[model samples]
Target: MDPRVREHAEIIVDHSVDVGPDDEVLLRGHPVAEDLMIAIAELCGERGANLSVRSSSSRVDRAYRKAIDAEDISQSAVSLAGAEATDVAIAVRADANTFETSDIDPEKTSAMARVNKEIQEEIMGKRWVGTQYPAPANAQDAEMSTDAYESFVWGAINKNWAAVREHQAQMVEILDPAEEVRIRSGEETDITMSVAGNPTQNDFAERNLPGGEVFTAPVPDSVEGEVHFDKPLMAQGREVQGVRLRFENGEVVDHSAEKNETVLTAVLNTDPGASRLGELGIGMNRDIDQFTYNMLFDEKMGDTVHMALGRAYEDTVGEANERNDSSMHMDMIVDMSEDSTIEVDGEVVQRDGAFVFEDHFE
Candidate 1:
């Protein structure tokens, strides 16, 4: 096994989820990541943690979804039981075929998401982390060779998270007490939302392996204006590009996509909260300098900002703030490398992707 694979597993077990003595750990991944899983399991054993491994196959999932009627889709009892019993849950993504589920009906996908929302929330309530394995399919999706993709993944994952926390703390301080934020990019994107009493979270590879973002929930009815996500994202096995949304009173009043508009429509129509802004996040990890078709990596790249359209994490919401609830939380990114400014309460903090505190700010 490559030393980097062990290092990746160490970060997941020791740093991300912090598996400890007697902890009940639920590990889920595809067989393609067996090496990484073995390393993690070994580490868990050394730590005296009990491990339960679940293997997933995208092809099998596609088959099941294709065969099942939309109305018959329901939450899996075994999944719910595992989620409820686990003390720590670690999910790894290693796709053999990224497009295996592409033909599944969007409505069926949405229905499944709706039914599994409870299990998702349950898992979210535990110590959990999600990371990606550099499978060939994912490498191809990112338009990089497998070896290059492995280097990229480990470079982003095996790092000093303490320094990252300190660096992102600056943004957390800026957003935590601010009442409102305005984001603008080129002539196509301009948006505003209230953070108000919401708490800002400084992520440093704990909840998300390779995490390097500062995020917070927007007040349920406080978002207004329009945003054009120039970056393309893979959603429901399809590439969605040029997503433009207009928000009125925190709900998406208008939406469109240059590609896969139907997927976007299905997502927005998933639930009542699906059309509202849930999270506002800023990417701070300069290490992830390139775009990957994966949200796990792309949303953490520097010179970008992301927003999720549903289901705010409870931790990011203040006791007094209303949390946005939905079955889905889809993140879309905007390029802020040029002609962009992030204003906090009317004062510009970032201009053209450089924060005011950085040495290069002009």
Candidate 2:
């Protein structure tokens, strides 16, 4: 019954997916986010949009995955059909337990992702947006109180998206026509990849609420060098930290992790494209100044860069460029707050997290 919850739902309906009259809107979220869902459903009703609600539960999913054999895991025809039929899909995340599926077999997780790739693609092809509802478990993971976490989530979500788009457009201009980009953080991370002919997407809370990144796909065979992602990320219900990857000819040749190495290995072995870079994104949302253990927000924090290891988005790749395809798209972040520079072509654009155009750039 918080005002921000209704505000969040309004953004999802009016700005994110833009549910119109007679549209089929599919809403999926945990029951904990029922208030927000109800707000969204009410808005959909007012707009004359048909609503299909799916209550997702991490516990239920964990039990199912634990009970099923890896080989027996298959895509649900109903799920695919629903995705195909929906005009707008809004997925809200509110985790009751961040590590609910940590005990599940990595191989089985990979298998499930592989089987559901089609469903994912079908949903992605629609007018869709994924946002998170501040939940107690997530707050604990972020090392923040519940009230503070709610404020953080809504502060990042309910904002001037147009201004964000305008601010991020500057980065898009630099990447859209660039031939190559180099990213470096201290001596541990240094990598270069070509972005020629790839379209840079300026994200501003449309597909991803709280979105404030400019992203593009790399040339499939043009990446070379090494990178150490100092930031930790949650993957497969486990925390993966200190990920270091060496790339040669756009494929990861060497990889290691300080934690959850097996999870990283499972992800890398998911498919052929899993070993290659799918996306190169620059975070420009200064409002999200802290790491919250949530990629939805962390990846958009200023002074950060994130790269996904699989499944390049269709819009980021040019028709002439090859799109990296995989069942997984895991984002890992690199801290650029100090001892870092993002070089476009040969010029330094961001030095120690300050873009050259920013007033603070030294």
Candidate 3:
């Protein structure tokens, strides 16, 4: 019955997924987000829409962690039952990391992730939107004060939509030339790839409006050399830091990490397609500087770039490149603020954490 829950529900139903009167909507959230979930259902009813709510909590995931033995968790009857039943899906994170820092098997965590990925892939038209209902548990160790973290999260999530037309113009100017951009994090990082002839960066306005990222599927076999990720990455509930991946002919030939090497190995070994890169995106929201351990907003933080290891989005590029596979799309971040440069074709477009077009746009 909290007023904020109704406000947040309106944001999701009216903005994020934009549920229509005829749309069959599915709303999923942890117990902490029950208020918002109920608000969404009520909102759907008011809007003349058919809504189904699938409620879950951190305790459910914890149960799976201790009791589940399968590598694929999505195969469970409950998950399979919800796969294609709705036109849109909303996942609200509420204290998901309740036990993240505790003692848990890495293998079990990865297995749970694989299940979620399977559900996402099978329900391709679901038009998923992920966000968070902040909980104290998530901010326990954050470097920034809780107030500051909330500000950062709010600014990052609403950055694109709040400014709308202006944000679109800025994106066009940054990606205008449509050329290959050479990037380096240091001698250890030498990654060069082409973004030429790809779709011009456009707003998801009226569709996936909360989305701040303007991404493209990378050239399947164009990625070459090795690069070390500058930010710590969390996957399948396990944290991986100081990752260095060596690429040969666009496939991950070798990879090592200072933390969670076994989990990384498991991801790379998921399938042949898992070894190849799929997405190459640069974060543009200047308001988001620090990491919050959430990929939805983290991958869109300014002066940073992330690459997904599997499953390129079909709408991102041409159909000639058929490398998209794997149930996973693990996004890992790299900082471009220090001792790094991005050369578009032969022209340098960014250096030392600044963009050449910053003055021209925004």
Q: Give the per-residue lDDT of model 1 (tens digit) for 165-229.
A: 99888889899999999999999899999999999999999988889999999997999999999
Name the candidate, 1 or 3, with the larger lDDT value: 1
lDDT of 2 at 8: 92
- The 10 consecutive residues of candidate 2 with the worst lDDT sum are 160-169
Ranking by TM-score: 2, 1, 3
lDDT of 3: 0.71
Which residue pairs in candidate 2 have backbone atoms (N, alpha carbon, C) closer than 3 angstroms, thus clashing? none
Superposition TM-score, candidate 2 onto the true structure: 0.91
Q: Number of backbone collisions per candidate, in order?
A: 0, 0, 0
Off by more than 4 A, model 3:
1-7, 61-83, 100-122, 141-148, 159-179, 196-210, 360-362
lDDT score, candidate 1, position 164: 87
Off by over 4 Å in 2: 63-77, 105-116
Local distance difference test values of all predictions, in order = 0.92, 0.92, 0.71
